[model samples]
Target: MNEEINKIRELLDKIEKKNDVSEDSLHGTFDYFELPQIIASVIDFLQPLLSPYESVIYWFLFRHSIIETADRYIRVSNSQIAQGIGSKFKSGDKVKVASDKAISDNLRCLMEKKVIVIVGDTNRDGTLYKINLPEEIELCIERMKKSRVENTCHVEQKKDLDYYNIAENRLLIFERDGYVCYKCRKQLTRFSATLDHIQPVSQGGDNSYSNLITCCLHCNSSRGAKPIMEQFTSDSKVF
Candidate 1:
């Protein structure tokens, strides 16, 4: 009797894998605000490799699982997959769904390509599958990483000039010092604040980011060319 029961348990286990929570599903921290970039990455890197049917199914699954729900796992059956890719109903043509075998074949091909994975076995509802993003696919990772680096370098190129002379780069200094008068500890707005040199231009200061400071008009004109120390000392006494 124990042997028979053990065999039954084993069969049951084989039929239904547990629907345990997956760590990847729990990591729902991806910013959907970057959805445009993610979509672009998919178009530029992943779409070229997929066949017509695979592309359709992959996009369908992506929309339902990731875009609609913001999770990678979904429980769906072969019939549902076929129906999702139903034939067009234009001009009263009878609507027809894809065959189960065709849907199964495409899904198997995707799994072999490592674009998706079966996370749990079939049950009354459906089987659980995990959809891999472009970045997560092993085949796409190297290209995706390269694209991200190129974007970063492009942004870095914008800052490769003199900070004091360039209006955009000048704002960087004011923003860095928070648009405040450094000597007086006064808050300032963009229109009212001015950039001052710690080492006077007449002395040796060139227009680099490190040599610049934010100051109000009053502190700027009053401290002109005076040694930087005088601004900090009292008019009546020196420390």
Candidate 2:
């Protein structure tokens, strides 16, 4: 019995040593934040007013500037926006591809709804869009509230996957992972981090919080469709 007890104690000690090494190695690679409560409030308020396409585009821009870049204004071309939101298109011989026209239409709609504004004149480069946060859209929120009351019975329900792509969920996943890449254990900021699925969607993974993790772009792209364990072997060095 004493021999067994000593063995167990030795195993526990080894585990603690390993944990200490991990913490030391990852000391500067993770960052923690007080989750931004405003993101949730903003997304909830706007969900009712936005069409599916509008919501997708808005969220994409929100992630790019507000979350990833930490900028109030983002300069983007219609082609860029279209690509980000997975807009479909087709050439004479090719299948569906990105549509810049669709992106332009959505931008115009968002501007008309006062959810975004053009910061300057359109130039050869691209348009600079100033994204309106929750506090910045008081009037639009009021109008949306009134419209919701008027059309209470006609509310639209979106899919779970779509909901997961909103700013709020993205923030939640970032916070949950301490803003570090799960695979490489590298520290990241809102602008530099991306959410990756432990199980690839093509392999039947869903977008639940349990399935999502914050990853740096390189690790996320490199680990595509590969098993998670393959990236974290004993011989691997994150740096």
Candidate 3:
């Protein structure tokens, strides 16, 4: 009687495996050793290979166990990927849809890297992607972060040259004009300050420090296409 009961139990187990379709069941059967920490590590490593949008899409798949987030009937396209990447829609027919291509390409790349696997077809409708964490992913993530930091540092250094030059010019202009708009005595913010040509650049004025004066935006805009002297005189105003 015990042997018959054991055989029945084995038959039930086979039925259970055959009928299971839930994500948990699939995971338990195929990747029984997977833990939340390992999944997180995989995402962290994958982040660098992806743009912000791609990273979002990749993680969404891992956490929810669903691919092709949009309606499958909508026909996955590149524009959808661009939408995910924050691009404005040109039209449904414009080029190819970005969302479909981006997801497909990234999935292929991830598979090639062995960070994930195609376990099976989804309900006979879509691909069942199983997530995995591998050592190369972690290493690749580290290298990408380092590259980003270096690139950021280089941009900052380039910007500093113009910033310092602007600062030095401000000091000289303040000394020359007593730190006020020549006409209004208004204090200037950086945007409010402008370098007006003493003589018009079109009328043979050279682009040199000595040939310019720091003027306010109000004065500059009011000056228009006319020379400064002509502008103030034409309007009969102090601007």
Clashing pairs in 2: 29-187, 68-191, 89-96, 89-97
The better candidate by TM-score, 1 or 2, is: 1
How close is every model to the real structure, measured as TM-score? 0.54, 0.43, 0.31
The C-alpha local distance difference test score for the whole of candidate 3 amounts to 0.49
lDDT of 3 by residue, 37-62 (tens): 33544554466666665566555555
Highest-TM-score candidate? 1
RMSD after CA superposition, every candidate: 16.2, 23.2, 24.2
> For model 1, how does the per-residue alpha-carbon lDDT over 42-153 read when each residue is reduced to its tens digit?
7876887688898899988888887888777888898878778754454566666777888889999889878889988777667888987664565665564455456544
Across 1-239, the per-residue lDDT of candidate 2 in tens digits comes to 99999999799767744543422232333232422554664566675678888888888888876676555567778877776777565668776645667777877888888888876545455776777754346454464345445543332232254314776567656655556687777766555678887767888877776667788889888776965655677887643
Clashes of 3: 9
Error of 1 at 81 (Å): 1.2
Rank ordering of all candidates by lDDT, starting from the highest: 1, 2, 3
Best by lDDT: 1
Full-model lDDT for every candidate: 0.71, 0.65, 0.49
Candidate 3 residue runs with Cα over 4 Å from true position: 1-44, 51-54, 66-99, 122-124, 134-239
